[model samples]
Target: MTTMTPPVTPPVTALNALGFDRPAADTRVVVAMSGGVDSSVVAAMLAREGFDVIGVTLQLYDHGAALGRKGACCAGRDIHDARAVAARMGFPHYVLDYESRFRESVIDDFADQYLAGATPVPCVRCNQRVKFRDLLATARELGADCLATGHYVRRIIGARGPELHQAADPARDQSYFLFATTPEQLGYLRFPLGGVATKAETRAMAAGFGLDVADKPDSQDICFVPQGGYAAVIEKLRPGAAEPGEIVHLDGRVLGAHRGVIHYTVGQRRGLNLGGGDPLHVLRLEPESRRVIVGPRAALGVARLRVAEVNWLGDGAFADAPPGGWRAQARVRSTRPPAPARVLPEGADTA
Candidate 1:
């Protein structure tokens, strides 16, 4: 009788950057392409790594209106550029019509928020309501393992599960705009460029990979708004948004009149045009009364603030958190570094 030798198995490969314990060829990734270099480089890098990369871009607004609109992402020109990148990478590309959804979820809310006398970050709302929520669903329906974007934020595995951390690049860290990212969305999202040390490196990667968007400029804040005029767009969206309003001092004295509350924001100190000896800053806006309250810089300083609509990404259950609360670093603006913070949980939703 002949002795038969058993066949040996191949060595197993460890999990990938995306946390998938499978071969890149066997895994599928849906990339949200904004027709910008960062996202283009991501798709190219994954394609070069042998992963099944699918490029999807959203038609966020009217194609006719978006024509010739530069320095804006998700515009018609951006959509065309994204298609070119997909073609260059030799992958199947898709363009989803999200005009109606964008108008409802982002544009309308932006106007409403400004009309309500509040400073709104529309990028956060777009990510929360549109990309991470709605677009992520489309990725799942396509049988993708995960959805990825070019945001400069890290998603690392902590003691509990996936945790959101600031990107290594401090100058390019976009954590403030992403504070609304829910714990569930954190699990399925990947940020390849978060580990990058600089935006230059991203551009370098694009150049090395021969992507056409290597020299493309980054998108400005409020991509839908042209010329960075927040008030102009709001006025165009909602007629009479810039109605005349009384500019009143903190001491109940009328200083002057303003075009609209939308033209002013809290902490603003310039363009008062009051011909003043003492400088005045915008303290608050009362849309109901259509009045702009002006005061000194000292009035803008506040030690305590109650933040509604909180998003918790802690490792443990929020309710199980310590009574004294979690000690963490927090920032009020993206331009400033995080300061010491005590997070006292009042309920399951807020702290």
Candidate 2:
């Protein structure tokens, strides 16, 4: 006569049965509300779940002064809307002036990388330096346990370690822009809209909660460059960053001239004024010679890529691995699926 144990209930069900006991009820969380629908909903949801939510919006840059544009993310109107939403949700909100930091970390780096002829991803840098580093530190100083954002990606806590996965909504997956996020940071970060919530659903939730950003249009341009162009912004920031350079063919013959090395990137086909018989593509950018290399499209395909500042998720994926070894899914850019690659530890700085 053995006494059989009852089946264990799931945590979600147990939590609900216990009268919606919020996992973070007494925990203080700093929500990075970007005056967008998704972030606004995140704040509201956390508040509704009985957690102490504090909203902080980083005033990254002046859209009007920088790009002579308005009505984009991080502008005056967006800040007002975010503050209004925080008020409506009955939470404390603060706008942190991060203009200088943003310029140094994101804008300056972007311009410098472009001038150096490497395709720069500013959003990744922003997430790494601004949001996670600066904002996360602020949250800690404010006695908050964690930082939350409106990223459309999922962080799954696995037996081995935490892993970042694509969002339930495939269309809005932001994993690419978040590749720079470290594993330690993931432990302190939360994405409330990770699971299968479409943009329409998020907007509806905002409307239901009476958020001021319910009808706000999604920001399509870079938050700093509201006018939807980067060339002008770079020119203004670093006057000589866009010096005119020569466009050359694969055979080292000068084809024509280009505005600057900053104007081109890998896989770019347009604006190359080389009137040759065959269509030309930007094969490579030689910053040393200040020359734009144009050639046929077949030169772009490479089986290997070197990603600097590599951050691994799992435990010891390459602990005993040799240099130029160890296979893993390498995501070159965000939004694209991670492709199979042999990741080798190049060096401390060039991983």
Candidate 3:
């Protein structure tokens, strides 16, 4: 008699916390450790949760030169701290030398943008070109199921797919610097600290995990440019970037001579050195004419701006926008709040 056997049922794999359809132990995650309390806490938390975690820190610059730098990240000291955290958590840690990549991608672009009279946010470029692009590639090469970071930006899986959202803690939200995150990168990236209510909470968790960076101060200035000295760095990158030029008023009157248009940005007031006149603010920077145009604060008001090389992270093709435009909220700077904006798609990548 042939006995009929019941078919073996396949176990369903529910999505894990990191959104992988498997158990935490089976999912390999790579945490981009910046040696800060926030990232260390993320690594520890994920390790405690039984996930196979690998800690990777990018030595973004010359380690010897970065040593003893306290207010910046990706330095020699940070790499050591990251390694220590990985050791404590019993996870494999690797430090990749990304100095050349950083210089070619982020640093060079920063200098060129200044020369072009445009204020460039190097952190955003670093994330867009190096960390999220190159480092994410490295993570995949390591066989990581996902790449996690300490960025205080939430990645929500909406009906469309993974959507970048502001962190639960608005004060720590890094959505501005992360605007360039592409959809494909969003799918593989996870931000574990996005839901944390506060930095204090992250510090407490780090302390609980016996991590060394529990009370470490947050990195303030750019990692490559120390002490917020943008002009000096620019000069070093491109000689004569700080060439002296005239600071002229909007009325076409020369107010005073100044050192380089790179030293000033639109809406600057304090460093003008006009001495005795109406409080003048930087109206615009003219790199070609080597001019720093100044005028009354009201002159700095902008009605519209043309943003180029736009990276659209919205639902559909940016070119497929409604005839009028898309009403949205836009944050021009990280320090400012989001304001209402009508994004008109001029082309595939501009609005």
Candidate 4:
């Protein structure tokens, strides 16, 4: 009888959340620490997994001014909390002073957009220019194979490389603020906590790791905008920015006086100070004439609107889509789900 030999099994390589098929010690990862519960949990989880992790916190605003400012990120307390988490996790940490860069990249742009009679999303701008853009570069220079964040957005490996998706927990989904994450940035970035079910789960994880920030409050406002006020900051940055303007009704009647067009936004209803027969809403802001144009709720409805600076991330090019345009899901605002949309390119710059 001939002896039979069993076939040998190939070694199974395990992949970490950062997607490296090697021991965590050999793969270096940079975690953007905000000293909040979510980010602190991310760093702690990676550290617990025996990864070679380096924690980096960005001081994006004035340290002195940010003291005792609760519910704000990238401030003095946040930096301290990040350092504490790193100490507990036994990982090296760094604090980068990015105040000037943030002001020019995000804060200034935010004020300018408001002055131009448009609502601005500074969180998106910060992610686009400061974190995903500048900070991602810093990670590469530090020899980090990947940069991980605590953001609530998913990155799935698809046929066409990495594809961005909403977080598993829809309530905590932050895909809107991250829509501008370029393909290149998406390739180098990872979100470890995106798959987690809820904030309570994150807090539990933080407690397990002995991180002090386990109970830290989530940041509620723009880090640079103290007490939820950006108008004052804008006025200080750009002297004479809040010039008086007229609030005019859609029917060409002057309704009231507005301090400035910057004080209002499209579709705003509150603080109009109009003694009216029926409730009115702001339809649009005319920056050219510094006017806040109001109308009935019907006028605020829009069948279509122009969106500029398109960033294409879907499969295939725009021209490859059907003649009528790509059948896709899109959201006009973050509060709503992406409904059915027929995206057609209006020009080179907009859709």
Candidate 5:
């Protein structure tokens, strides 16, 4: 039997229908422009709405040396485009040098996670450390009331305080990556394109505003990995982390050799060179033994997970004062849906 899919709605119509109004002329907002169409449109819309808008782009990395030619929207050309858009829209623009901070927070954490045999979500860390945390601080320093981004997620402040909702455009909803945002940060954050439904619509709006990046393609790869591959970056940071290792079966029988432990992740099936019988999946990586444990797919199901460095949204939700523990939705990874969970304080470092 075929299942019917839900109808998709654009963020613009939904947000307007929800009665989200623009700020007044005296209200100030700082837009994080990344030389992308969505951010450009956001700045233009806010400016047109008569709010005091200031555009800021974070120079997070050495894009010229990394990308070789420097024509992309993430680095060199993107900065120029952002400045041009700000000029055209009659808003003040500034570029913040955040390369050292980005490297320390994002790049180092990424390498450390791979080294630790766990998949790290760098985007979440970036948002937590740089965008929401650092950028929001900068906004406040500039005396702005709010900071805005092009992220496709809606912030709703209700009786229970601030709750993040999926964007009206489900395909473009970025709520997953934003799970790390604390309740305090959500209060000062705004996602103008959270209500936008499609890339086509964003581009159309940009074109209407005569923005330079109207036809620019959305960046598909991580900004740091210019070639769209991370293996090289991993090798560069940890020289011997990708050395060859033995691939063993769950029963302790030797199978084949793997290029490296960093090359694999949980629930991966492809590129395992064990002679074909039933398909095999990576169950675990024994870093100490330099061995990769392969098994059938059933071994991948994990009902319980211990997440450290927990950031609770509500007061005392993770404290010891709870009778039955706090009940809320928990998400381990950003892309996955938040599962029902009973949160208990496992101490500061334990979570």
Candidate 6:
């Protein structure tokens, strides 16, 4: 009894590059490869660090239709390229068929939003619904410690938790499109290319790793949209979405007839074909009334507008917003710099 038992010693835990308390080999990472130079470099870099890397590519649409399509991710050609990179890097690769999920989540929403006279960013929807949500879940099912991606956005560790930040390279930053990433998803996500200065640097890394995708062109436009034809895709998904309607001026004047409300977006000025008059911009679209409302550029300006589905990444609960509203930077467009603004909470999800 006096010589009872030896004291147990706890193993020391150290933070690796991914902030995981384990060796690189012990940390299993699932990289979402889009078959581009950006993703290829990420997979290769992790493999070089001796991590257990598994590359997964989602076939979001019909590969048969995407066989010859260029400048799109998750296509037939892209899947092939992703597989090649995985083979070269000596990591396991997989292709998951997510066509049905994509249609329900992204494609259908895209067409519906257009029908409702609102322009939808399918890329953001795809990221929010498919890649970060579904694919991240798949990674967990495979026993992965975290999911890594080639997105040009940083996940900085803050006192509160992981905070999403703009990439070091502003020119290639994709932070705007990734605004929907929730706190929980941010915890399990990693962006290896976030700190890279330029696309050329990523390409260089790919070349250094001897990956064949080093020179592959970057994915352009929406992955599912072919030939940059948004209207055609919408029409195919929802027949007769392009119903012809009257293009009316602001002052209750019918200027011309437009093919459909889907063809013109807000703030559009060209292709009106009104035949010589003051330039008019698309003030808004009234799909229910089948009206393409147009007016002078001055009519497009607005001091304030309500935003819905607000994803708060800031401190504390969204309901904590003061009655006067909170000071914040608002970005209306991804290409535009964020402007000073005050955000008043309308509800838990609206602002």
Best by lDDT: 6
Please provide, for model 6 over 49-107, each residue's C-alpha lDDT reduced to its tens digit, 9 standing for 90 to 100.
99999999998888676667776898888889999999988999999999899999999
lDDT assessment of candidate 2: 0.82
- Candidate 5 lDDT over 24-62, as tens digits, reads 566788999988888899999889877889999999988
lDDT of 2 by residue, 150-206 (tens): 999998878866779889998899988898788889888888788856889999999
Comparing 1 and 6 by TM-score, which wins?
A: 6
What's the residue-level lDDT of 243 in candidate 1? 84
Query: Each model's TM-score, in the order given?
Result: 0.94, 0.88, 0.96, 0.95, 0.86, 0.95
Instruction: Between candidates 1 and 5, name the one with more favorable lDDT.
Output: 1
Off by over 4 Å in 5: 1-23, 66-73, 314-316, 320-345, 348-351
For model 2 the TM-score comes to: 0.88
lDDT of 4 by residue, 183-210 (tens): 8899999999889998889899999998
Error of 3 at 194 (Å): 1.0
Q: Each candidate: what lDDT?
A: 0.88, 0.82, 0.90, 0.88, 0.82, 0.91
Q: What lDDT score is found at residue 187 in candidate 4?
A: 95
What TM-score would you give candidate 6 relative to the actual structure? 0.95
Backbone clashes in model 3, listed as residue pairs:
none
